[model samples]
Target chain A: MKKTKHKILDMLLKHPDIHLSGQKICDVLGCSRTAVWKHIKELESEGFKIEAIQKKGYRLLSTPNELSEARILVGLKTKELGQHLIYFDSIGSTQKETQHLAEDGAPHGTLVITSHQMTGRGRLGRTWSMPKGKGIAMSLILRPKLSINRIPQLTLIAAVAVYKAITEVTGIQTDIKWPNDILVMGKKIVGILTEMQTEGTNVKAVIIGMGMNINANKNDFPEEIRHVATSLKTLTGKEHDMSLIVQTILFYFEELYLRYLEEGFSVIKWMWESHAVSIGKRINARLFNGKVLTGLAKGIDEEGALLLEDDQGSIHKIYSADIEIE
Target chain B: MKKTKHKILDMLLKHPDIHLSGQKICDVLGCSRTAVWKHIKELESEGFKIEAIQKKGYRLLSTPNELSEARILVGLKTKELGQHLIYFDSIGSTQKETQHLAEDGAPHGTLVITSHQMTGRGRLGRTWSMPKGKGIAMSLILRPKLSINRIPQLTLIAAVAVYKAITEVTGIQTDIKWPNDILVMGKKIVGILTEMQTEGTNVKAVIIGMGMNINANKNDFPEEIRHVATSLKTLTGKEHDMSLIVQTILFYFEELYLRYLEEGFSVIKWMWESHAVSIGKRINARLFNGKVLTGLAKGIDEEGALLLEDDQGSIHKIYSADIEIE
Candidate 1:
């Protein structure tokens, strides 16, 4: 089905400078030449410009900035992450699909990406607006063999990954707002939500949902979020290639994830603190129980919990809270 | 559906000492008398003996020892737990069904019960043998607003609940083997597996799977587990009613869950320690990293972690391990 088409497109993109013959594609994919021709026609309908010469084969001229599986897999240099990608033209939520797939034994590094989310979800049961073909709505399935107590460090690790990806891809310098929000020029550009399945102290799987505004303009956001939300297009006044961004994120994520698995969370903590905006600043943290504590935002502890220094110079380890910089 | 049939049987069991007329049953259920008669015939074919007197009514004379929803819900007095029950003649695993139902927004206290589990699962990916119609294979879905760190306590709380239930139902003295195993006469009788869906620090749902060996004779167990596993019938030399055991477990579980929610884990800790068999004994703990540590089991800490005091008097907080009493 679509998998074969993706394989064909992957082969074509693997050698973007040269043309791939239909006979070779048919041989590699174990399909007939007619089927490859049909797939090429389908790809053309999806805004992929392919140049076909007489007996020379087909060359991928240009790919529209779509989050298609083939486009994302073009230059994805990760060894495991994003190797098994599930792309959806539209979906309810990537988190929901990833949960179902994880329950059905989806392996580690399996990715669920959607061009649009009807009901995009955030932390604390909040909803985020994700227009079609405008944002990166994805969920990665991670099976980390770590104790459940150390699960909170995953959010910080993901924040660092996203920060590094954005900087490396788009040359955008973003500040991580405590746990997982990436803010550009004091506006939220990305949100990371980490969920896990645990049996007692054993962590079976971790699904990290990341929503980043990539190509949305100022008018794409709703009136309520216009002042607080910014996208790459709005920040740079140009449309960026989303597939490249996804590929770069996967690359950086796979590296950091492997590093974290090998050598604890020290590197992640250091990277996160280097880009943390609230550290050394006065802030107010709203606890989950409706109590707000005003303090100076010190760096995080060993377990990635925020350290807040109150007026008495005592440090409070804030486990779960919403921070507001003052 | 089987739900309606269970409702009819529930009506019959609600007034076991008296006869229920067909006219009254039809009036209550909003069904025709013919349908009621058909349901009664079906129940009879399923091993339920209903004595129908001429022109008088129908009386439940006796019921086969089966884990039917009607049997389990007959005298259940829980407020929330087991209010919404999904019964199956057989299932692969109640935990699988409960996990799916929880993801689909099943409310708290939803129960998934089966007459048998084709593939009964245990902690750390182990498999348990659950024969058809001989064990209580059930999973309860709990949505508790607690932090992820407090989740490990659920296994201990459920252990205490099951211990109380077994003691009250059969008057058998059982011992809690620290985290989740319930042992009787130095043999395992019950195993509890608690799993959860967590986002950052917020716990969305907790699926508690409990498998108790009930009504199985000595010959019912396999040769491999004969020395390690024991059942209620094997211990008391008499068959026990399993529906009553399930009802009692639900009663105790709901009470303890609510208490843990309001009063914290102090009460649960005391009850768990009172029945814990490993405390004050020398034991060997096999860690997840293939390392074994032998020490004196010196009770659990505040977070329900096993505190192993080694020969050198240094205490080790064992997070994830398999304990073997030496």
Candidate 2:
């Protein structure tokens, strides 16, 4: 946080591949060798892994880590998504962080990521397990000029992007699970969390928090979740490129998001239908009102709610509920 | 925050009329006079004013003359609203505090109030002035079961509640300046800043930051803001009770919120229309695309968007824009 340390950081970041000698750094910083060592110690504390050789110099090594600011910024290379990234090694939740960031005037495209979240949560504050370094947990901040009715489409767009990104990078054949999750072979591979800040008729910010099971082994999941949860490495038998996948997600997202703003949902409606799990299948949507409608999954309505037609021909627009394939 | 302090608070709330001596408080709390003195000093630091005489002993005088924690919770009785009110004498902003709290899983109804805001803001990050002891600057944490589409209504409901509370308590008869401001006699008196923390589809918490000019004088307003901003005392020519106004706002909100859940927009729509400066007026809406549409206000749609009917009878829903009365 001091000026000398900030100068050292600037030097390292500017010359990513350069090695700086302790003598040179100490002389340039006008500090003792102990002070230079302390500055490096501070950088290490910030999750920058640097190797100090006796004769050669200090070489900055990019470590494969979770919730490291450098790692997140390295992966996220969009004008919007990477502008600001906040990382927490163990947080209550990433969605909560992004929401807080949005509230504090963190502009559209601010990102929050966390790994090894002790109290990670899902919808309705349900426990969201985030094993150490086994998944890519990230959230995106977006301030769009959108009305309330058009907000649900953001979920659909995110689901589509995640599914596309995972499939493109890992070849996992992901499917849209409606409203919020991504599935592969009847098991959830990814979960999306969307939180918003609104004022009157305008959306203050919409944060899209995503959790993807990337490198977790079967043992990584708890016994209760082993049946319903899966990882990219577990599915594919090899580690997929996380940075590449992140890039593809941001790229596809920017495209989809722009389309969503300029042209509405038609651009990706057919794509979503193709990747969706229950398009033509008979499914039972358990409504919160205690009404169970066993119907064929027709398609998504213009407002992004799932449209289901029953055997008797009554069309039901389900806003939010547990979706079960029968 | 300490056990004995909470005990004293409980005693004060339970017995508001009677005064308690230090010895009696010591007896009630099972502590020594020195311990009571230490606790009193700690409470004083937290802004709880206590009177101690040579023979009369100690009596809880006024809450530390602060909008901070002590005074915020003194007479506060709420099942939800401000159940956990954190007062900051001077903060970057209450929205920032609430955001941090939300990220740390602050309870759904947690409230943050600041005596003076260093970085108070309005919609789209505009500046909002918050001078000490002259305004009620607070933010409430709420978790609404909104699908992003219904999120905007919360602001309108808050605006209506603010208008009603200001007029009823201060007798100012303030007019709703559409969307989020309350104006008294064509001068701005209150500004509502609603910020939310949300992820993909789940809303974690919305911090409703409101800055209401309470006892500000004419000289208190900055030269630039003098023409625009006015306080309750400035309009009423006398200082008004802030606690009464706070209670009134919360009461109206609870009622309007209940009615909103039961009957939807119909409950508060007319109320907003009655106090608003938008309906049936000729206004020019400055669109983000640099296009301005001059139209007569029809009313708000179901999703709380401004419904504008042009002279040609074309209905347009204005989402985000600056509407000026022409």
Candidate 3:
């Protein structure tokens, strides 16, 4: 199958520093020499330069640099999360494509990633800083059989996944702010945008859009965002391995996803509570309509709304907003 | 402006009673006969058929069907509700198009109505029947500057508007069941599907997709749905004016919408409480996880969740599911 072939090539691609002979490649692949040669030839024709001299055997000289089906399959780790990856080298926005895919019945765990985004987006209609090959800008197309009431759990799950992945791979102490933002040293490093389709309270599909600053630098961020935006490389003082982080986060995400389906929010909510910063702090949440609610930031309620306990002991459950810890 | 020309032609199409000469049309339009003639010709090219004679000048033929900008403009009434009406005649789904537009900074209240949908949908990814020209299948795009907590108000407003419009035009006593479905004598007559875009709780835009059965007969109902769903004609024994109902609903909807922005849910909640069948009734709400809650259907809580009072007098708030009154 195409999936098996891509996996073999992906395993080879993962270790670019190593070289393998035809017998060794065939033994690991558990396939014949002719099939391996054919795959190597196919990879080279597709831009991957595989050195295939008679004695020298096979060595990965180069791989076709594309966000195409072949490359994404080879790059992705999870069995389901990004198994059916729909990647575009340059797109208007990955969120737009993911929405379309969900409408067209893309499986729950399918993902849409783009290398460059001409019309990239961030929270609150802000433009996302999306230079090609600098970050992971992808949208997970999920057909979660959940009520619209539990939709906020999608944001919480994504915040936890991205935070853990960044920390595990880049050694950056990234912290998730209340609802969605991921911050490193009090500067924003990742953003989560979620959209859902519902009829009344029945949720049809949920699109979890996550854009993480993987390799972008200080100059890449806009002047207005310079004071608050930071990247993984900027914080770690090196270019983090995007592949390893992608694998780890998606693996963790799928595990969390299964827990969400089986155990409901108990797992995700507990993990989010542990990962999040401002659980019991004094905070001011600024709503979209210019109204402000100042209270002690209590834990999230059962429905995912933040419970803010005011000085009068009245707890105002905030559904969605930008929160500032005072 | 382009809008003026569209307005003139649209007025003629919907008014079957109105007839005018080229000179009369020119006078009413405040334009030269040549300019009026040019717009009419453009309408003809776009699909509108205009009957032309020497004295019996520019009578819009009843059958000159077109999705011409002029036709849509003539039908739209509100200042903001349909300030920009995009008609595709046939699309994958109007909801998809409107979502794309909303993402691209299309002003809120931009309506997308199609005559036919290749992939029309209902809640929970169900296949909604959208036959060409027989039903009112359209998506109204709204950009309400309200928190995610207040977003559920749109569904309540839409359900009330749909219920009122159906009653006003057809004399049918429709009840708004909990959440958003419009039912006539215990069978669903209209369905409202609300999709939202949010960054945490700040709502960027909400698309309200309504699929109302207008002229379909009992035979038009799918075999599986024959027992549960009924159309306006099937129930009332008369075909109702869809456009008239759309206009009336929009007019009322705008009032309530403005009220919602100014006063929140105080007045609207009272209206919802008046017609709500579940209020004070014993009901069983089937949740997503196969758990059922049997309780008295109290009113909605401050955060828009349905309050269910158990036999023990403890209140359990239900969000997101179908409630069957036991």
Candidate 4:
């Protein structure tokens, strides 16, 4: 957002009920009254309902329904994360966009977000579709100086971050499904896909893509996933602001990510295990090699690999798999 | 190379000592005599010397000193490693190009080769410069269905392949330096870097980039690395054919890569250990996190991590590090 526009929005938001005169806005912003009126007009065009009176000046009635760079950044509380945000109305995949940005030497905490993704991506080459303006599809680019083996731990860290953000915003707790999903009552409310680009064992970038069904109704999802997916609005019977959710997630992500960097994966591993839904449950893991291992989920190892105790009481560290509670 | 050009080159290379008439070339290629003459002219322009007799035929005198697509493919014995090739006279970096190709759905074993690299890359953000027309810079894209943890093994496998190829071609055996470099008599001659793009522990594509100082002299290298770097021409006191070495390397790469997919890393691990110079030697390994551990280098484990036994006799698994023999 431009500096003057952000200042105007801040003043109007600070006092939502009162109208500030154009001369007062001009004095606060140190600009002409014509420039103040022009900024007001611009904000109105972006879906902000502004009431204009002959003597009472302008009152900001409501904000835009859509997400904008200004909207996500107005109250964002991060030092570096999301400071260099690239917002999109619609895109093929935020993950791909972040990958390209990372390749082009994007900063550490750059965020690429879209209101709608035409071709969303999920873990292991699965298709993820989200309704326009009803879901949050965002990819955060991180350049952590860690070994390649530790890259998987970032997924668990992200799951924990999203879990906390959603719970804090809605006052409704959500269960993290092992590595990447957030489940509400056995239905998936969020999906997280972490992709990495590495050179030999040196990591170039890690892009964490998260998609949450924020305001979608029962019929908004595709038929196949409708029975298995739930939304915050569907569960809470109200519309939740997506920009706030994005800001909260970014806030929590910065916090946990900094903690992981300073301390290690120990703190993150404990938090992940605490929120994981698959811990201590009887589950069947379909391994990448087309073999299924039926066992009891014994939580993740230090490296974030799922530890499964098979029927023979032997523990196997499953690196990549699709697990289901049996 | 175009189809007809490849066919013409193959015919000429088959009978290098004798002359083949344009009429015979036309009949074999199913093209016109004028077309055959045009191909001969094209070959001549690419540095192939041909002697045209009055009535007899055309005799192939010598091949090009520079690399060409037709030259490399003529006697190549690989199944699919270099079957689909993207050749360049000079490129920025074959690794970067191959990464882009992999993103665009390049098939497994797609090879990208360049006679020269403007900006060659070494592991851990090092610059690798090669003299024009004197080195081999190639990147191969492989889509292996393996867990992400196993991706590091591909670098060790590539080292073994390059070791075998150089020994077979130049008859001067080289030493595999733990993970990436191939050294001959305490000097670096070849470097291999394996990079990967992954989605949440699932391997998307692994690009194995190999850069070899094939025919460079001492003065061709930069002043800082001149004493530390040696090439095939410097070691053997004769110029080795670059195309023949490339073909040999690709042949061995395909054989060993297929064996890895079929059997496992056991075979490749054994091969790598046998040729490694760091095994059983006292070394200082500078890890990625800036801590240097001085230890005796044991052989690599099953997953290709270097097993280092420190002064206290405690063994540590070194995943990504630079080792210096003490």
Model 3 residue runs over 4 Å out of place are A1-5, A10-53, A60-77, A145-156, A185-187, A217-227, A234-237, A257-326, B1-6, B9-19, B27-53, B56-72, B185-187, B219-229, B234-238, B273-326
| lDDT (0 to 1) per candidate | 0.88, 0.75, 0.76, 0.88
**TM-score for each model:** 0.93, 0.79, 0.80, 0.90
Q: For candidate 3, lDDT tens digit of each residue in A1-326?
A: 35556865776776677677778878877889888878777777656677666765766776543334576566566778987777676788898788767765689888887657778787777788765677778888777776566888888888888878777766777778878789878888788888875545556678888887777788887788789887877876777655566666787888787888898888788888887788888999997668999989888877778889998999998876789989
Q: Write the per-residue lDDT of candidate 4 for residues A1-326, one digit (tens) a residue.
A: 44788788888888888989998999888999988888888888777899999998888888864666667788789998898898887899898778777766799999999888899888877888888878989999999988778989999989988999999889889999877899999999899998889987679988999988988998999888888898998999988878878888999999999999999999999999999999999999998779999999999998999999999999999888888998
The clash tally of candidate 3 reads: 1
Weakest 10 consecutive residues, lDDT, candidate 2 chain B?
Answer: B64-73
Off by over 4 Å in 4: A1-8, A15-42, A52-58, A266-270, A295-298, A307-316, B32-34, B54-57, B311-314
Q: What is the TM-score of chain A alone in each candidate?
A: 0.94, 0.81, 0.86, 0.95
Write one digit per residue (lDDT tens) for candidate 3, span B44-119: 7766667777877777775332223454455555678866777776788887777777766788878887656678
Candidate 2, which CAPRI tier? acceptable
Comparing 3 and 4 on DockQ, the stronger one: 4
